[model samples]
Target chain A: MIPTISVFEHSPDRGQGLARDMSVRWAFEEVGQAYEVRQVSLSAIKQPAHQALHPFGQIPTYEEGDLALFESGAIVLHIAEHHVGLLPADPNGRARAIMWMFAALSTVEPPIVQREIAMYMEHDKTWYEKRLPLLEDGIRVRLHQLSSRLGKADWLEEAFSAGDLMMVQVLRRLKTSSVLGEFPNLCAYITRGEARPAFKRAYDAQLAAFIGKPPKQAN
Target chain B: MIPTISVFEHSPDRGQGLARDMSVRWAFEEVGQAYEVRQVSLSAIKQPAHQALHPFGQIPTYEEGDLALFESGAIVLHIAEHHVGLLPADPNGRARAIMWMFAALSTVEPPIVQREIAMYMEHDKTWYEKRLPLLEDGIRVRLHQLSSRLGKADWLEEAFSAGDLMMVQVLRRLKTSSVLGEFPNLCAYITRGEARPAFKRAYDAQLAAFIGKPPKQAN
Candidate 1:
């Protein structure tokens, strides 16, 4: 049986492919694995049934027979471990690739998310204008480190492992902001990730889900 | 040879066990692995050699013979995957444990870090007091969900795994904040994790590293 993954019925990103599920879907496409998506609405996501699958009431849970998993990073890792394309076979290379995954989520993404939260949740606050620069600077620190590391490399490492997939996805969240554009190499790095054929397929799939979806009012 | 992990020579946290290295050390102790620590001062951490090991130039990098890995979450997972005590042997249990590792780092730690940034970076601003409640509330939401999911259970799942290790570390960040006390079960969960001999050993090791060191000025 094909593994099942859950996604937003009406994604808050409005088909921008910034949702966590997009990366999971991209991983599946990269591995040539066919899976099914179960659409979940915002309200239904917090319900008991959904909460059982994800304690934090978030999206992109994976279920394969008796095994269940949440957290997109973990789900992507699970897919990468089961499939060959997303991770390297060499022990050291694989560990380094996983390191990138953690860096992308834990190190890079948090500052970008703080900026997102400020824009979406606290835009009306008096400190909003004053705080935007600090938020941007926080992201730039990470971007500079990432750019230095990505210097002239096609991917984070030798190949486009799940690390690149996660890092690229996290960087894409900054598409609306000018902070990512300051580092030309970083921008090119994201471009290369988006240019992947598997990424295109996954992007199109998430975009299709957004079509005919009533625009989400709440995140 | 024992694996080598790098940590801050003069940790900003003043040996409070909030630094990411604390969890990595805890994981090692949990698994009964004897690992060596290489102390990294803040300036040295950003040097080329350090950046080669960790792209972000952060601490708690794992080096064993030819393998080098960074990111505390990844290092902890690496230790868990290789050791018996940190992860379950069964496939499903292991995946769930890893899922919690991601959840703790990706989901729970972000808000906590955001609050930390606000407090440390923006404390003198006029908006600090007004925004402090919002940050605390943000933490409360996650704590509430985690507490509810935890209920009276001694651990997150059937037995203590790396999930508890990561979660407890994440929660310990909130020890200074009153937000953690709102959820008694979560507190007990942390208390239970701390009660473990492995955790005590890890905590003592990190604490010992801070002895006689002039307190760090920069984060």
Candidate 2:
């Protein structure tokens, strides 16, 4: 049976492909896999059924037969592990690739997400101006380190793997921020990732949701 | 040669084991593996050598043979994959275990880290009082969801896998928070994890660093 994944009924990201579901969709597209989507309303996500599939009550979650998994990183990883294209064939290469995934999620994404939270919730607070710069500086520190590491390299490592897939997507969250343009190589790196056929397929597919022109389901 | 993982030369967490390296040490103990430590100071980590080992220039980077990896989640995962005790043998169960790891790191850890950042960097700001509640509430939402999912379960799954290992460590960050006292089941869950012999060994090993009673190396 084909696997099914959950997505927002109406993403707060406005189909900018910023929704976590986009990563899972991108993963599937990269692997040339066809899957089903289960659109979940925000209120419905907190309900028992969705909670059973996802303990945290978030999207996107993956389910194939008896296996139900949550967290976009895990979902993307599940796709990468099961598929041939998204991971390196060598053991060490594969481990390095997975390490980059953790780096993207655990290390890089947190500050960006925090900045968004501050901007969204605390924008009107008195400390907004004071705090915003610190948050941006936090992002800058990570980006500088990442920029140094990514210097003159196409992918993070030897070839494009799930690591690049994760890192590129994480970095994309900073698209709205002015700091991303400060690093030209990183910008080019993201450009390279976006130029990929799989990324285009994924981006367009998610964008289609907002435009009311979602691609036809494979099922 | 045995692997060597990096740790802070002088950890801000002192001997509390809140350091990310604690998780790696705990994983090593859980798997009954021998590994060395390379203490990295705040200034030293910013240097080229350490940056080469870890792009983000953070502590708890693993160096085994030609492979060097960073990110506590990735390091713990590497240990879990190489060693049998930390993961279930079955594929589906293994995936579920890993899914929990992502949940802990991606979904659960962000807010906790944000709260800590606020307390550390923004406590002097005017909005500290105003913003603190929201950060704690963010954590509360995740904890409530987790508590409901956990209920009275001894572990997240049938057996304690890396997922539980990660989730347990992530939750430990809130030990000082008043909010944690509100969830009895989650508290007990952490207690069960800390009660493990492996955890005790790891705790003592890190605690030894602050007390200058470092454990003798196995190698």
Candidate 3:
């Protein structure tokens, strides 16, 4: 049986494909793998059923046969391990690619996520406006270092591996912000990632799922 | 030649073994692998030399032969991949073990680090005190969910694989805070992990390095 992944019933990203599941979807497309989707509502995510799938009650848990996994980065890695296209065949190349995956999730994403949390949850607080700059500055530090490292390279490595997919997904969070614009190369890098056929397929699928959803009728 | 990991010449954790390097060291100890240490000063970390090793210029870059990798999670996984004790022999179990490693770093550690950032960086800001509880609450939500999942279990999984090693390291950051006390099971889990001979050996070695460091000469 093919893998099935759980996603938000109505994604908070409004079909922009910013949710964690986007990476999983993108990985599947790159690998020519077929998968099913299981949609869970925000409230339903915390219920026992969802919690059993993901202890943290977050969406984008992957299941195939008896092996189920949580964490988008891990799921992507698993798909990359089982699939041919997502990772380099060489041992050292594979290690570095996986290293970039950790860098994307562990190092780059946290600050961006912190910024998002402030925008979403802390905006009404007295500290909202004051804290926003600090959060943005944090994101800038990571982006600048990443931009410097990227230079003229099209991807983080020799070819577009899962690392780039993960980094591109993480960087996509900054597309709306002026901060990402400061790094011209990074901006262009994101464009290249979004331009990929696999990424387009995944993005279109997630967006279609969101738009296909019927708006809730008034009770 | 044994792998040599770069660590902070003066660890920000002040020898508490909370630095990112701790995971790499602990992983080495767990697998009974010996390693060398290369200490870099704070300013040195941002220089091109360190940058070449880790684009982000973070500590805990592992180097052996031609393979050099960064991100503590990735380094630990690399070690686990080559060694036997850190990962289960089965494919699915190994997959889940790596999943928890991502969960610890990507999910669990971010909130805790956010709280820490505020404590150290934003304490003087006008919103510091006011914003503190919001961050703590964010952490509490994760801890509560984690506590529930960890109820009566010694680790996140059946055996002490790399997953537990990573999770315990992430959770240990909370030990000095009041928040971790709310969940006795988690506290016990940390205790169990820290009690391991491997963990103690790694902790002692890192701690010794910190204490052994000579104070900077006065101008």
Candidate 4:
């Protein structure tokens, strides 16, 4: 049976892939997994039914048979584990790929989230002028470390696996900032991920969902 | 040969297990893996040597043989994958558990971190009062969903696995807010995890490291 996942009925980002569900959709598409997207309103998400599947009442909950899971990382990881394309075959390489997955969510995403919160919620605050730089610096520090590790390598580690997929998604959030432009190689690297046929399919799929329509008729 | 993990020589949290390294230590203690801690000062963390291991220049990088990894979730997940006690034998069950690990870091921890930033960095802002409540509500919404799902269950899933270890650690960050206390079951759930001998061992070890001495010359 095809697994089912949840997504916003009307995304807050209009048509952007910034919502968490985008990652899951991208992962599913990459793995050739036929999945269903259950549209969830923000209000319905907090209701008991949704909470049962997702303890945190967030989007991108996955269900296959008796197993129900939440968290986009977990959902993507599950897809990667069961499918062939998302991870490496060698044992040590596989473990390293999983590490990159964790690094993307835990180490890299936090500061990006902080930047969003600051921009959205703290713009009017008296300290906004002063705190913005610090937050930016915090993000730069992580990026610098990442850029250094990434160096001239195409991906965070060898072989673009699910880890790189997730990392690219996280870094894409910084596209509006100058951080990505600061490192020429990282910018090209992100561009490469975005240019993937699978990523394009996922991005267009999410954008379609937001517009309340299917993909535009192909030329 | 024993695995080696990285930690702060002098933690900002002083003796608290709030540092990311604590999660790695807890995983080691749970799986009965003997490990060594390599302490790095804040200055050295920014240096090239440390940056090679952790691009983010954060504590709790893991190394076994030639492999090096950063990100606490990645490190802990790595340890869990190799050690039997942290994951389940069932494929579906194991995947669900891993999902909880991501949920802890990605969904749950973000708002809690926001609360911290608000409290510390923006305390003097004119809009602090307005912003704090919104952040708190954001956290509460997640907590309420989590509490309802937990609904008197002993753990997030079937049994206590690495997922629960990470979840408990994430929730513990909100202990000071009284938001967790609002959910009686969740509060008790965190306490139960903390009371475990393995958790205590890890906590004490981190505490000892921070206090610049052994665990208070245990009674």
Candidate 5:
């Protein structure tokens, strides 16, 4: 049976693809998996029913048969593990890919998320100006290290795996910020990941869902 | 040859077990894996040598043979993947377990970490009081959903896996707050996880490392 994942009925981003479900959709499309999306409203997400699917009342949650899963990273990993395209076949390489996945979520994403919180919620606070640079510096440290490691390589690791998929998604959050441009290679890498046919499909699909239309085919 | 993992030479947490390396130490102890800890000071962490292993200069990078990996979640997953006890044999069940691992880091840990930042760094801010509750409520929502699903179950799933291991660690951050007590089942569940011999061994080992002494055996 095709699995169903939850997404926002009307995204807060207004079709910007910042919604967390975009990653899951992209993963599914990359793996060529057919799935359904159950659009959830903001109020319904906090209710018990939605909470059962997602402990945090967040999108997206994956359900198939008796199996239910939350956390986009987990959902993506599940898709990657079950499907052929997302991971490497070599044991060590596979483990490294998984490591990159964690690095994206745990190390890299935290600072970027912090920056978002500061921007959206704490903009008026007295400490906002003081704290913004600290957060950005933290993000820059990670990005600098990532860029150096990535060097001239197209991806973070050997080939494009789930790790690259996740890292690209995390880096995309910095697209509007000057932090990304600080590292030229990393910026190009993000563009490369974005240029993927599957990613284009996923991005367009999420954008379509937000705007209430069907996804446009990539040119 | 025995594998080696990276850790802080002198942790900023001052042995509070807040450092990321604690999780790696705990995971190693859980599997009875004999490993060595290579200490990296904050300065050295930023140096090229350390950057080679961990692009972000974070602790708890793992190396076995020629393979080097970073990110505590990824390192723990790697250790769990190679060992028998951390993951289940069933494909779907294994996927669920991995999902929980991601949920712990991505979904559950973020709010708690935010609360920490607000309390510690932003305490003097005028909006601290107003913002603190939002973050706490965010955390509480996740805990509530988790508790309801747990529903008197001993573990998050049927058997104790790496998912539980990571979840328990993440939830432990909320111990000082009464937030966890708001949900009885989750409190009991964390207690059960803490009472495990493997967990106890790991905890004590970490505590010992911090205290600069051997681990004490619990009665």
Candidate 6:
């Protein structure tokens, strides 16, 4: 049975694939799994029905028969666990890959999101200019640590598993800011992730959601 | 061989068990796993050897035989996956339990941490007074949604799994603030989690680390 995922009806990111659903969609694409999407609006998301599926009433919920799940990280992990391509076969390697997923969502993304919240919502505040640099500093620290770890490696671990998929998505958020550019290896890493055929397919599908058309195939 | 976990030599949260290691410790107690603790000072964590085990250089990191993992959420999830008491045997129940772990870390905890950052680091900033309310509102929204879902239920799901463990820990952070008090059910829910023998054992273990004593055993 094809799983259905919930995404934003009108993505606030303007189809740049920055929405949480993009990661889940990318995971599905990476595993060559066919799935459906159910678009939910900002207003409707707060309703009881949507809240039932997701306690936080957020997007990118995975519904497969009796199983209902939210939190993009969990949904992506679910897809990766059920499929072959997104995770390695070895138990140790698989556990390490899952660790990266948590690291991406919990550690890396928090500072980035804080920066975003400050920029988007607090720009007019008195502390905007003063606080912006502090947030950026936090992001730079993470990026530098990540860049140091990546070095010349193609992926975080051995192969391009879901760990890289999640880390790349988290890093992509920094593209609008100049923070990501500070680390050349990190920038190239994002470029490499985007170059994957599966990522292209996922990106196109999300972009197409905005235009009300079928998703374009990857070249 | 017993697993070893690295924790803060001097935890930033003092002996309150707010440290990430508390969750890992709680998971071990719930699963009845006896683990050794390796205390790492903040400076030591940044060193090359520790950084190899944890790229982010944070605790608690789990090391069992050849398998080493970081990210508190990942480590807790790893403990839950391997043990019978932490995760349900059924796949759907397991997926939902995992979802709450992500929700606890990603969805619910971010605003709470942002609020903490504001209070601790940005207290003297000009916009602290103004921005403080916004952060509280963000936290309130999450608590409200979570409270609604958890209404009249013993746990988030059918059983008390790792999901509740992670959520309860996240909520415990708000005990210092009055925010958690606003939700009565949520407050009681936290009380229930704290009343658990396993939770007491874990909490005492963490507190004992601060006083250089052995952890109190569960009755």
Candidate 6 C-alpha lDDT tens digits along B90-121: 99999889999999999999999999988998
Off by over 4 Å in 1: A213-219, B212-219
Candidate 4: Cα lDDT at A131: 76
Colliding pairs, model 4: none
Model 3 fnat?
A: 0.89
Please give the distance, in angstroms, between residue B157's alpha carbon in candidate 3 and its true position after superposition.
Answer: 1.3
Tens digit of per-residue lDDT, candidate 6, span A65-173: 9899999999999999898998899999999999999999999999999999988898998889999999999999899889999999989999999999999999999
Give residue B101's error in model 1 in angstroms: 0.1
Candidate 6: clashing pairs of residues? none
Candidate 4 residues B1-219, lDDT tens each? 677888899998787788898888888888888888888999999888998887777788888887777778888888898888899999988997888888889888888988997798778877688778888998998887778777878997789988899989999888789777789998899889999888898889888888877432111
What digit string (tens of lDDT, one per residue) describes model 2 on residues B1-219? 789999888889988999999999999999889989888889999999999998898888999998989999999998999988998999999999999999999999999998998899888877788888999999999999999999999999999989998999999999999999999999999999999989888888888876677653422
All candidates: TM-score: 0.96, 0.97, 0.96, 0.91, 0.91, 0.97
Question: Per-prediction DockQ scores?
Answer: 0.84, 0.88, 0.81, 0.69, 0.69, 0.85
The parts of candidate 4 lying over 4 Å away from their true place are A123-131, A215-219, B123-130, B213-219
- Give the lDDT of residue B150 in candidate 4: 79
Candidate 2, residue A65: Cα displacement in angstroms equals 0.5
iRMSD for each candidate structure, in the order shown: 0.7, 0.7, 0.7, 1.7, 1.7, 0.8
Angstrom error of the Cα, residue A204, model 5: value is 1.7
- State model 2's lDDT: 0.90
- Candidate 3 lDDT, tens digit per residue, A39-121? 89999999999999899999899999999999999999999999899899999999999999999999999999988988888
Give a tens-digit lDDT track for model 2, residues A1-219.
889888888889998889998888888888889988788899999999999999888899898999999999998888999989888998889899999999999999999998998889888877788888899999999999999999999999999999999999999999999999999999999999999888888888877776677553421
Would you list the rank order by DockQ, best first? 2, 6, 1, 3, 5, 4
Q: Assess candidate 1 and give its TM-score to the true structure.
A: 0.96
Q: Which of 5 and 6 is ahead in TM-score?
A: 6
**What DockQ number belongs to candidate 5?**
0.69
